[model samples]
Target: MPSLSQFSRCLFFILLSMIVTQCADKSVEENLADGIKFTEDRQYLRALDAFQQAVAKEPGNPKAHYSLGGIYNLMNRLPEAEQEFKIALKIDPTYVDAIYSLGFTYELMGDKEKAQPYYDKYNKLKQKWNEVLQKESETR
Candidate 1:
């Protein structure tokens, strides 16, 4: 059997390791919230880091990709923004904001032809969403 002092030290180390692991491992939603807060503060680099962490934690999350793309767009990193938005759309084809942002990013890149189809898709989706809202309101 272990001595009392050795057992206490071992338990203390185990608890410390658990706390450190939990601190190091932020949830995807926590990272996303941090990114949003950083963006609101105009801390672009910190926002980028937070968004990247969110993406890493949940690569299939369209919201994470969309939020990352929005930061890139605000920073005028149009090509990267376009790529992230495309990834988001790949994960969720009906992601309206990503569709609109991708089109806007293309326009910013001076590629009007490329932008048009995305813009058209966004408009169609928006129209459908509005119709759904209208029907819901009518039922209520």
Candidate 2:
């Protein structure tokens, strides 16, 4: 037999699971788009909600992680932003934008040592991407 607190905890988890399941019903892209729109509208809380849903729906999606990180960064949630950006890099190591943003997050948090490697990676990737674009344009 469960005690009152035990039962309450169980009930809470059940409700939370149900909510998460319902949120997962939406596609990751839909959530990401909603997050972007909400951010553009300056609705930070709504944007956070959408990005969180995107992350829950697609845990391995780098874009979802990046979007979530961006929202956290905008809201001055530095630790959460760092975590999400790191997750994005874990999912896609060559995610130059996330690398750049992670560096920026660290800089904002006053950790220049931690920011250096990410900034270096971002700069390298940006240069390579630019070269590719330039070559493509030359061929066109």
Candidate 3:
């Protein structure tokens, strides 16, 4: 049997881990929001830091990747923007914004041919989304 001290230590560590995880989740959201605000203010470096933090905390989050990509695009860092947008799309293929942004990035990089397909995909997805919204409105 574990000693009382050992049991207490184990329980304390478990509780600490739970608290850390909860805080990390909230931090990621806060970082993402802060990044957006910074971007709106045109503080690209600060926005980059905040978005990078969010991405680090939540590597699988498409929104974080998208936001980071947007900052890169604004800074004219086309390659980085392309990469982040691609990662976002890979995480969520139906992310319309990422799809559009990737195409825009490609266009900015002077690759209209590569951009065309993504633009097409974005348009099709938008049309489908609008149709769904229209049907929902009709039902209502």
- Top TM-score: which candidate number? 1
What digit string (tens of lDDT, one per residue) describes model 3 on residues 1-140?
A: 89999999999999999998875666878999999999999999999998999999889999999999999999999999999999999999999999999999999999999999999999999999999999999998
* lDDT-superior candidate, 1 or 3: 1
Clashes (N, CA, C under 3 Å) per candidate: 0, 0, 0
Q: Which residue runs does candidate 2 get wrong by more than 4 Å? A: 1-25
Instruction: Tell me the lDDT of model 1 at 38.
Output: 99
Q: Estimate each model's TM-score.
A: 0.83, 0.79, 0.81
On lDDT, the candidate that comes out on top is 1
Runs in model 3 deviating more than 4 A are 1-26
Residue lDDT tens for model 1, 30-122: 999999999999999999999999998899999999999999999999999999999999999999999999999999999999999999999
**lDDT values for all models:** 0.96, 0.94, 0.95
Writing each residue's lDDT as its tens digit, candidate 2 over 1-140 gives 88999999999999999998877688889999999999999999999999998888789999999999999999999999999999999999999999999999999999999999888989999999999999999998
What is candidate 1's CA lDDT for residue 2? Answer: 90
List runs of model 1 lying over 4 Å from the truth.
1-23
